[model samples]
Target: MDLFTLTVVNAFIALVATGVLAMQGQADRQFRYQRYFLLAGGCMLLNAGISAIHFSGILLPYWLIPALTNSLSVGASLALAAGIHRHLQKPGKRFGLLLVFILLFVLHLTEFARSDINHRFLISIPVVLLLNLWCISMLWQHRKTELGKVYLAFIATFAFNILQFVFRTTFMVLEQHQIIQTSIAPVVHNVGFFALTAFAILVFCCIILLSHSQQRQMLQQLSERDALTGLLNRRTLELRLNAEFSRCQRNNSTLCLLLLDADYFKQINDKLGHATGDLAVQHIAKIADQQLRDYDLLFRYGGEEFLLCLPDTDLPAALQIAERLRLAINSAPLFTPQPYFLTVSIGVASSKDSQSWQTLLQQADQALYLAKHQGRNQVQSYQPTAAVSR
Candidate 1:
């Protein structure tokens, strides 16, 4: 290969590798189907460099071509298949999908070794098209989404390159046996091969960029999740509740808030130290979380108090959940030296379309005062029309 050709291919590969590295650095989730974009992009760049070196005709054996090609092809195909399945929430279908590729690719390689690339192309071209079509079609189901649009672009670019390969591979082997006209075959095959390689790198790089954008979004969500309680932290709850409160006011819907404090939490702290206190709170949160529905928002409001927001849940249901949580805490002892028990006080408040979050919290606090007033371990509801007791 000429220096110019080598330089162009290497530069393109380097660009793809750079994109994959940038995406991997930004990946936030422990594992996501999109992260495979980074993994596969990096592999392709390295493989491209190897192929470019081989193109220079450094006297490698015939076996190396099919061997190396099939090896990399197997890996890339599997990665893509698994990633696509997971991205589409079809993980249960992964093995069946993978088996199709394995059968087609293995047969294609076996025919190529014995019968030459031209004969193999007769089998592989239409089959490869169908395989590629299947993968792209799956992602096309997601075209109504933003991320799906990204994968669609990937399929478009990749499908074009695969078609180019079928054409180029057919001509190269045909020219070898003088089955085609002499003059145009070499130029067309060389040009097509280089162009397909470049296009494939470009497609892989674009997938990396799209994956990185998605990863950033997940990172933002993760920052809002509480580590201990698996609930939204105070800050995220405040932001969400404020927005929900505004909507409730416009629509005249009821919004409820529950304030809860663990009774004698300080005793856990004094007797068992801060670690047990933390454990106690975490255990209580886990139990409380089970009683609420998925749409309800739970938060470690601050220190020993937890706040729960139940949209459309009226005073009665709010009080019911609170009391259930209160009793649940009392029934379970947090390993308190065989005799001690754990209990919590809960205050419930609900209003019809209250816009002010601050005032709603104030009312919940007042209800908590009523709970403390009645006794330490009980549930209380706020009544705005009633006079405040001194």
Candidate 2:
């Protein structure tokens, strides 16, 4: 299609994108990046509107049209980059992006930029290319995170836009040097505009998908995690425990469970208030988390109890870990109204001595009873004879 037709189509697309993004931003106010994307869509719409007006033979100033359109185009690109940075929770190059727009606007005002279309293309397209590259780099760096794989679509879209810009730049250079036929120039320019419109659609779709995916993941985590301690909840325990149990059964490896309970948690709540009681639980949880290995799974098993699943760990090693956790909690001071130190009683049980995870959990619970029965601040290992005797 011709330039006017392409400009009209682009304007319509930008208008739709701006409206959709505005609704999305309003609906999901928590997604801060959506605001930046809304700004980008608005800028693109303005840019497309100006281009349509310029091509429609509306009488506008010689330099004013190009200046406005180029500045808005560059602003849209910068907004896209800013949104990506925000999505990744990275610091944005705000001052630098502003400087780039300032420089581009100044260049557009110059007689050099207004005198030739090629000069304008050379001035503005490279700025956009660099911004696109910056966005790709930011997304690439974070491509391994939980939501990183979803960014592949975004990266591919930006990469395609980069190539499209390069292609346009090449055509503009060849035309500037009088290497390409005049008849072919409009075709290349229209192709560039078409590519740009397609890119705008693809990138915004990717953003919407990413936002939904992130929201879904957050909801899933909230469902499976303890609200207070931020550890795995009992709801997730059975699934994880069964998996670990089967793995150990097949490999003949050991899987140990350390059932931990905060000592005198009720007293802290009754005397210092439930708020401090909550703090006490949090304190013990924090200490246990710090003392454990990365592969170990910690869960908030009860009001003031935590369960640690240590795969491939023997009973002796589990006991040592349990003792270390007990000591760590005993030493840590919780700032209460009165002077008080938090402690935990840990019960260790190994899968090697049990037929199933249920039996193992029972063994750990019985051992926990023994530790509390003996006194509140010690680690105890499950012994079959001792448990039977109890």
Model 1: per-residue Cα lDDT over 1-390, one tens digit each: 553375357547755565755566565455466555454554455555556567666655544454444444444545565676676777475566456556654665574544765555555455545556767778778877757667777678767767776677777777888898989865785677577566656656655666665777667767997777767888787689898788777788888999999887888899789988888888888888988898888888877889989887788888888888888888877775554577888888886524498889888888887887778799988877755585
- Clash pairs, candidate 2, are none
Return the clash pairs for model 1, or none.
Answer: none
Model 2 alpha-carbon drift over 4 Å, by segment: 91-93, 247-253, 312-316, 388-390
Candidate 2 similarity to native, TM-score:
0.91
RMSD after Cα superposition, model 1:
5.2
Candidate 1's TM-score: 0.73
Can you give the TM-score per candidate against the true fold? 0.73, 0.91
Candidate 2: residue 316 lDDT (0-100)? 89
